[model samples]
Each structure stands twice: as C-alpha cells, then as structure tokens.
Target: MEIGFPNHPRRNLLKEIEWIGKNGFDFVDLFLEEDMATPEKVDVNKTRELLEKYDLGIVGHTAWYMPIGSPVKALRSACIAELKRYFRTFAELGVEYVNIHANWPGGLFTDKEGVKFQIETLKKLVEEAKEFGIKLMLEPLDTRFDTVKNISSILKAIPELYLHLDIGHTSLYGRKPEDFIKKFHARLKHVHLHDNNKSRDLHLPLGCGSIEWEKILKLLKKYYDGTITLEVFSRDRDYVLLARDKLIELWNKL
Candidate 1:
C-alpha cells in the first residue's frame, strides 16, 4: 500500500515535499486548496521534478466545496469547468487519481434534484478523466447530500467512477467502514485516514479521537492496495507526524 500524507494548503511547497520524502512517506496528495496549490500558482514542471527527486507518488485533491452538483446554473457550470480544468492540470502533473467531494457541503443532504444533477455532472467529469488517462475518485461527506453511501446509485449512473473513503467522515456519518470496504472493495482506490467522534468531522489525529482502528485497517488491507492519505490536520506539523505514526502502528496489524 502507498501510505502518504496530504500536502494540505499553505506553507512552502518545496520544503513540505522535502520533508515528506525525508520522513519516509510513500506519496503526497496534492491538496489543491485555495491560496497555495491553485492551478494559477503551481509550477507543474518544477513540481514534477521535485516529486521524481523524492521518489514519491502524487494524487490530486480538488478544493473542498467544489460543487459540481449544485442546483444553480452558474455555480454548476463553474464547478464543471473547474473540474475539467483540474483534471487536465493534475494529469499533466502526473496525478494518477483526482478526488472531489460528492456534493456541496452545508447543502440539503436529501436534495433529490441536486443528486440527479450531480450524477449527470460527474458523468461528464468521468469522461474527461478518461480522456486524460487518469481516474476520478468521488469522496463522500458526512451528510446525506451527495454521500458515498449513495455509492450504488452513483456507480450505476457512472460505472467508471471510483471511491476515496474518508474514515473520519464515515465515522461522523455513523456509517460502517467495514461494510463499505466489503461491498465496494473493487471500486475503492484511495482513502483518507483520520480520527473524529460520532459528532462532527474534527479531522483529529488517530487515538486522539474514537474509532476501531484495528478493525478498520484490517478491512482496508483485505481490499485496498492503493493510496491511503493521512488527512489529519493541525497548526502544529508535529501533530500530523504523530498521527501518521499512530496510523502506521494500527495499520501494521494487517
């Protein structure tokens, strides 16, 4: 398995890449959040050179709240354009899998019309990904709106899609990772590892939050053998390192 940490927004990109490589991560999820890794600011040639220098794999994470399924016409159009644009850019940067959230956060979880729009929009995005020769992964948020729990419906609608499971979000939604891992193992390609309570998505480090790590890791080992990203975020970089170590310890059970 390619175990890595998300190069989240902010900080010096080169330094972070250097640190990730020196510290022994397998890859780095290029989290293109606002401000730092936006297509406008990133130099793909230099980025690729650095990644090769470190011998680390790369993945692309679209900005959170990238609502390709919005009901609003203009918003949806902008989202689709952004998705296509990112697909081309990330593929150029050698990102194998590009991830986007299922739906707009803080929107109606039960928005039937919205979900329909999402499926159609994603169909186009998947085709774009195919053109780029990379995979598009859909990540599920905690709420019902555009959730990975709707995996069956989404997959039926767009067969080429894959899943990026966020452990913290699943726990917050009260969904069982074991069940999804077993059922959708074939389509599950990427993962985000972190800790959160039954409440909101805290994005805390492992052991600092509640989760059955051993069981979850075992299920993951049984199915997925691709990239698993540490999504643990904190102002203190050391905190993320600590979380990564804890996750490695639990994952060793497999």
Candidate 2:
C-alpha cells in the first residue's frame, strides 16, 4: 500500500512537498482550501512540475468551504463552480481521484432527499470529470445527532461513484472500519486514515486511538490500491512527525 500526506494552502506548499519527498512518502493529497481552490493561486502546471521532480503521485481533496448539498441555491452554485475549476486543474495536473464530502445535514432536503440530490450532483460531476480523466470520490462524514450517519446510504444511492472512506470518522460514529470496507468493497477508491477519540474528531495517529489497525489494514489490503492519507494535525510539528513515522511503520508491516 502506498502512503501519502495531506497538504494545505495555509502551510508552506513547496516546503511540505520537499518534506514529504525527504521523509519517503509515495504521494501527497492536495487538500484544496478556498484560497488554493482556483488555478490562479495554485498553478497546476507548476504543481505538477514539483510533483514530477519528487516523483510523487497526487490525489486531490476538494475544498471544505462550500457544501454540495447546501439548502441555499446560491451556495450550491458557488460550490459547483469552485469544484468545476478544481476539476480543470486536476486534469492539467494528471491527478486521478478527487475526494469530496457528502451533503451536509440541516439542508432543505431531508436525509433521503439529500441523498437523492447528492447522487444527482455527483452523477453530473462524474460526467464532467470524465472529460478530464478525473474520478470523484464521495466521502461520508460522522455527525453528532441524527443525520446521514454513514456512507452506506450515499453508496446505495450512487453505486457507480467511487468512495473516499474516512476511517477515523467511521470509528467515531460507532461503525467498524472493516465492515465499511467489506460492504463498500467494490466502490472503495481511496482512504483517509486517521484515529479519533469517541467524543471528538481529534485526528490522532493510528495506534493512539481506539481503532483496530490490524483488522482494518488486513481488510484494506484485500481491496484497495489507492493511497492511505494520514489526515492528522496539531500545533506541534513533533506530534505530526511522530504520527507520520508511526503510520509509515504500520503500513510497511501490513
């Protein structure tokens, strides 16, 4: 399994790229925040050049600012516009997969209605993405109360679309990561590998939380060929480095 690190616009991009290369990661997940969402700030051609220099592959994470299933029509439109721009950039960079979050709850659409709308949105996005040879993966988020809790509903709605399973979130919401893997085995494309305490989304390292790594890893190895991005962060750089090291070690053993 190939390992990857997450990149953000707030962080020094070039420095992070160089660091990933030096630290022996195979690829990087470009987390497209609002500032870096446009082609202006992040020149795809230049970014590709750097990745080529480091001999790294890229998988993109879509911007978190706009929710695809927002109740407001204007917000949804804006979100789509940003995503379209991102897709164009991905095409130029030769990036294959773009990870996207599913519809946020509290929208006009009910849980079921939201799923339908999201499926339609994704269907359109996938068609557009095909032109650029990029595939979109829908991610399921864990919520506090009653909401679209897991990926199962979304996956059921859009069977053809790919999946970006966030293992940490799955565990946080009381679902077995292995179960998700087995159930969504066919559509699973990429993964966000992190750990979290039950109470909050802490983004801890693999062994630091309650997730069962060996079982999950064994199940993952059976199906997935995509990068496992360690999505953890803290104010302390040492903590990040330690988590990165531990994840690499675990991946090697698996």
Candidate 3:
C-alpha cells in the first residue's frame, strides 16, 4: 500500500513535503480548492524538484468550486476549461491520477442531466488526458450538499472512467465501501481512505469512526491495484499523526 497525504494549499507546501518525507510518507495529493490559489502560483519546477528529491509520487485533487453540471452553457464551458488547466498541470508534474468530483445536482442540470453532462465532460477530459498520459479518477461525494451523492450513480453514467473511492463518504451515506470495490473493481484507480462517524463527513483517522476497517482493508487488498490515500485533514498535528499511524496499521493488516 502506497501511503499519501492530502494537499492543503494553505500550508507551506515545501515545508509540508519535507515534513511528510521526514515522517516516512511516499506520496502527496495536491488538493485544489476554490479558496486556495492556483497551482501556477507555486513554482512548479521547484515543486517537481522537491518531489523528486523526496521521492514522492504526486496526485492532483481538482478544483471544488467549478460546477461541471451547471445549467448554463457558458458556466459549464468555463468549468471545463479550468479543469483542463488543472489536468495540464497534473500531466506536467507526472502525477498519476487527477481526482474529480461528479457534477452536483440543481446546477444547470437535474441529477440525471448532471450525470449525463459529467459523462460527456469526462469523455472530453479523457481524450485530453490521453495526450498527457494522465488518468482521471472521478470521486463520489456524500449526500450532504454535494452534487454527486453515490458511486453507483457515477458508475452507471460512465463505467469506463477511473474511480477514486472515498470510503468515508460511502460510510456517511450509509453505503458499504466494499460494495463499490466488488462492483467496480476493475475500474478502480485510486482511493481516499478515511473514517467518519455515522452522522457526518468528518475526515477522521482510521479506527476512530464507525467503519469496519478490517473488512474494508481486506477487500482493498483483494480488489484494488491502486494507491490508498489517507485523507485526514485538521489543524491539529496530533490528530494527523494518530490517523497516519492507524492507517499504516490497517495497511499492515492487509
């Protein structure tokens, strides 16, 4: 199991990279959220140098603000453009997977329409990605305010697109993460392995939440051929360390 941490751009990325290397991590996911600045601001050449220096594999988390399913054609086009830019950066950095969220509902499209749009959008993105030799992994968000609520929905729409299964989101939505692995096992490309209480989308460390970590890890070992990213995020260093240690333990069990 190749372990990695999420990219919180608010933190000094180089420092974080050094810290991750010191702590024995081998990969990092560069998360691109709206409030966070673009990856362009960070010296890509220097970032790549550091990653190579630390021997860390990079993965990209695409932007969260743009709505790919927007009802307005202009908005959707803009979203696609921004996504392409992110994808381009991922390709340039030699990142393996570019993680994307499914289009939210009530944007420019209904749930069904959003799924259709997302599939179409993915087709275009996949074509573009092939040029860069990058793979796109579409993730299923929990039902909270998110547009894409379930794995089944995304699979039904575009069975061929790579999947990034977020176990914490699955548990929050009262769905079994194993179900996804069993059903979409072949399409799985990466994972966001975190835990949450039964109530919310809390990115808790392993074993602290209601998830069956043993069962999940067993299934992951059986079915997944991709990296397992521990997606715990918080300002507290102790929480991060505890979660990281627990995740390593779970990986050992596998």
Q: Which of 1 and 3 is the better model by lDDT?
A: 1
C-alpha TM-scores of all predictions = 0.92, 0.89, 0.89
lDDT winner between candidates 1 and 2: 1
Task: Indicate the worst ten consecutive residues by lDDT in candidate 1.
Answer: 104-113
lDDT of 2 at 41: 71
Candidate 3 colliding pairs, count: 3
Q: Which candidate ranks first by TM-score, i.e. highest?
A: 1
Instruction: Rank the candidate models, highest TM-score first.
Output: 1, 3, 2
Question: lDDT value for candidate 3?
Answer: 0.73
Candidate 2 lDDT tens digits, 29-143 = 8876756445657766667778988899888888654566666667666766678888887778788899888765463446766666566667777777778888888777765
Candidate 2 error regions (>4 Å): 107-109, 144-150, 252-254
Q: What is the C-alpha RMSD of each candidate to the true structure, in Å?
A: 2.0, 2.4, 2.5
Q: Give the poorly placed runs of model 1, Cα more than 4 Å off.
A: 104-109, 146-149
Full-model lDDT for every candidate: 0.78, 0.73, 0.73
Count of clashing residue pairs in every prediction: 1, 0, 3
Q: Can you give the lDDT of residue 134 in candidate 2?
A: 87
